[model samples]
Target: MSAVSRLWRRAPLWRLCVYGTVFFAGLAAFYPAAYLIRAIPSLGKLHPGALHGGTAPDASKPGPGPGGNGGPPGPGDGRISFLPLTQGLTRAVPFGGHVLPLPAGVWHPVLSAQTGPNGAMLTDVYVRTDRGVVSGMVVAMGTAQPIPDPNLLSVDSPCHDDRAYARGELPSGENVVSCWAIGATPVHDAPGTLNPVVAQAVDRLNALGYPIPPLFMTMRWMHLTTVPKKGVGLEQADVMLSPAAPGTIRLPVPIDQWDRGAIAGAPAAAHFVDRMRVWAQEWAPILERGHAGTLDPTTIPDSLTMDPAAPAVH
Candidate 1:
């Protein structure tokens, strides 16, 4: 038995346990793609004002955010999801208060939040207020209702009454509100379009005397981006919607640039929020039939024409 005990009895214990189980399964598949895959990275590219949560598979965006609202269910009624407004989303989005008066901590969203109808988030928040670089509508509407903005105007909160659940003031002095329950721009709303226990049709303003338990964010509209006197160049920004300037459908959504192939300026502001959802469905019933007083200016109706080559403001 002297020949190394007969070569340990011809050693090959199951071929050395199959070459040590194929060398620890080849270091457990190349030691994590060769050294823990470059310290794990890759999810940092969502800033077209970034904000993506749900309901966007392609509803009607032929060219923005690569398509979401994800088509295939329109009159059947059912299914709605949308997101893209941040502050860590928890059901209250009133950036820099007074719906963005800046100054305390500044604000956000200069562009990108078009997800509309029922879930309607809308966007364009900027503020350096005291009347300088003002841009509003950091809106969110799971339907707090109150669009009867027949030229809103009625203020006091100056900067942020916690985003004043009702501040109002447009005809261009700017100042805005009507925000609430915004934590990803919510809204599954329909049954009465929203308001106390589902009450309905409200541009309602006996000085905005309703809503006590937060039926959840009304978030009407607010638009104004004029900055000239030789200072225009945010691609020439100049949009002015929401019964502004002596009213009559304050047109001016000239945008001209920033499509960068979509996803950020949201196809350059969804060609003006598809004309503000065709003015909240055909000018919110003629702006709630002139919201109780002085709003006679109406006329840009080629389906609220935002000029797809100019022709529809019939």
Candidate 2:
């Protein structure tokens, strides 16, 4: 027992409480700020091809790995390499007796279930960009609802009942199902118009020289899914494209004013279909191949195309 023991005994409880409170308060403030910075566009640097994930490396010229970045993985390399808004990275996940090719910045994993019994599993990813929000899902030999009929497509959102459905087959024979609908609500009625987080983000964006337009637009949703032979499984991607509603408050233009044919023929609607077709063509062959690794299935040892121990695909 020395001077240190005496000092410890004299330390006031109030002082300790103040220090603890400050530390916890700092932590509480830090996390939400970090999340918003990532979630909000303009808050972070926009990677190239924000709409389609970052632009893919030039196929004409040789580059490094899947993404064009050459050097070894540094500290910045995340565990999954699929972080939200991260561009120029691609991964192939094995599923449903096939592989799901995750497009570069376009598909960022939001949630994934651990491989369940008998190779049952599910994965969900999203791409939020200035034009729209795209959601991609993969169900590996698991039960999921079938694609909705055209009339029922809008049931999931505040969209009108009238929807347009389109179907086609990829070059590789995979089935493609698509539907589009217009949202029904107005922007002012949508939630989060007055949210403090949203307001602060808008202010920061404008301060950074990115001016936001009036929060109104025609909200359009397109849901597309690729079906494997016999409907064994599916890879689904849907996009909700808003013309004017850039921020969180997504309200729709009045349906009465917009002709039904006009909505289907809009430029945004065409763009959504174009993107979906590109994704379907790129992914169909990969799904039938049933391989996720860089090396060919024939070259790999144990003849295992996917994970050996986990049997990720059926």
Candidate 3:
């Protein structure tokens, strides 16, 4: 009835047998070859620690000698060796007229937008981790606006609206405000106006092969007054660590307010909150130095033989 049936009927018995064998073999080989082609590209972007089934070593921890665990690769390694997390981060990059510690690993630049007075700039860098969690930081320089104190927000507010907000003062007296939100305002949602910066940033990230989840939980820390004596305006940094979720959590009753402790205790948010806490403290001083114009990129050792020496934020 069909051409294949006609060929099968006319061919001699051995010819049919050989043709059938070749056809089945090629079919089997095609799938594996296709799978390999799809998988090979991701291998280059994988976290090195992922290969070993553990988290990458802390960036602050020094590696053995040259090109060791926490250090950048030496000359002999013919390929670009993957460093765990933010290790091998040896230089500060300029952003919005201030220098900031650049995140390593899969973290890449998303958007650097200037929508503030006098060309004040806001830069956001983000990455989708191997586990599908999204983590990143936003730095703003010479900005007139200050992060609102969460304590003053009304209880009816979705998040950062409770007295449970936490605050700490750095050794140099800069204020650090941290908060967590279970159901944050979605960056892009239907029936609402879309922010141009966020829209463009998402497009760029998608172009770079990173996918943004439809819904996510957010943990944020806002560092205030990093440039204590800036003549023009305030300099601030906001860091966010968010994990993707399949859908927004449903509540039995309307949420009147959110308590940080309660949110941190929730099973869905506990892990991300803990990681955010550790990262917030670790990044505070480095961000401070960068905003204060005290971190010099030139002093960072190429070999990463030792940590760079920068004055405490004043």
Candidate 4:
């Protein structure tokens, strides 16, 4: 007791107070320093690049700033655009009740004939009929030789019809004639009679010097019987006018090899025959005038009979 009391009495008050303050300050500083040391690994994980110099920039991450890759326009961008030439020159014609238009560069010319070994100028004709639209690629040639009027045919004369006379009423010799190799699809459901509108239209074409035959009585029918044989490939039909037969105008209407399916809705054979009469009449002037050159048969190369298996008449 004597020694402890003596030591306490000897200790200074200011020194004791200073020692307490220093101890508290040390405790406070130690806790903060330990916390900072423990937090180093976690902070490094948060900023990997800061710790590792090889770290790459991650574009997909929520960025410190905005950035992106430029991409192409998608399908929903907009509509397409187009351009065409010869805009107004295009026209549609009805054949066999179907509507067809000339090829891009084709033009319909006024009726004119050709001569020599060149034969007829072939061209495609379109007609709209009750059955549908039908097309005929026709090889037409004209002769300078004059022909007698169809109305002036003699009784019992084989050339009584326009077609007969046009084909050259007689066989023998080189008959200067215009021939048409017409390939067509049949018309179906056409009125039993011709449509007057179509008839008039054809008549107008004839008047305009287009080589449609006058044999067509109405839009639906014609009296010409030879057309079937000439254009449709009927051997026994008797419409073909032989170049060798005198006074026998050979109207060899050669039809191409057609699929029966194509003719399903075409006009009846009888109706077609009748229409041929009108066609013959319409073409009479062109044929007699030998204006076959007006036809551009090359436009329809595939319509011609090129196959040996095809019928001789077609």
What is each predicted model's overall lDDT from 0 to 1? 0.24, 0.30, 0.36, 0.24
Worst 10 residues of 4 by lDDT: 63-72
| Root-mean-square deviation (CA) per prediction | 23.0, 17.3, 18.8, 39.0
Q: Model 2 clash tally?
A: 2
Output the TM-score of candidate 1: 0.18
Question: Which 10-residue span in candidate 1 carries the lowest summed lDDT?
Answer: 63-72
lDDT of 2 by residue, 110-172 (tens): 322212122122223333233332212222222133322232222222222333222233233
Candidate 1 Cα outliers beyond 4 Å, as residue runs:
1-186, 189-217, 226-314
Compared with the true structure, what per-residue lDDT tens digits does model 3 show for residues 1-314? 99877776787886779889999865443322212322442332243332123221111221121111111111111111221233223346565467765433334444333332222323334343433334332323224343232321221122233332333334545333322222232443431322333344445555655545443333232333422343223344433333433222232222222234466446444444444444444555566667668877665333331111111100
The digit string of per-residue lDDT tens for model 4 on 202-251 reads 33444544333212211111112122222211000011111111122122
- What is the alpha-carbon lDDT of model 4 when measured against the actual structure? 0.24
lDDT of 1 by residue, 1-314 (tens): 79766665687795677688999865543332211222331111122112232222222211111100111111211122121223322111232112211111223332222223332222222211112212222222121122222211221112123422222333332232221110111112223222111121112111133211111112233231223332111000111222111112122322222122331344434444454333334432332223223333334343332312111221
Q: State how far residue 158 of model 4 sits from its true place (Å).
A: 16
Instruction: Name the lDDT value of residue 81 in candidate 3.
Output: 20
TM-score rank order: 3, 2, 4, 1
Stretches off by above 4 angstroms in model 4 are 1-134, 140-267, 290-314
**Model 2 lDDT, residue 74, Cα:** 15
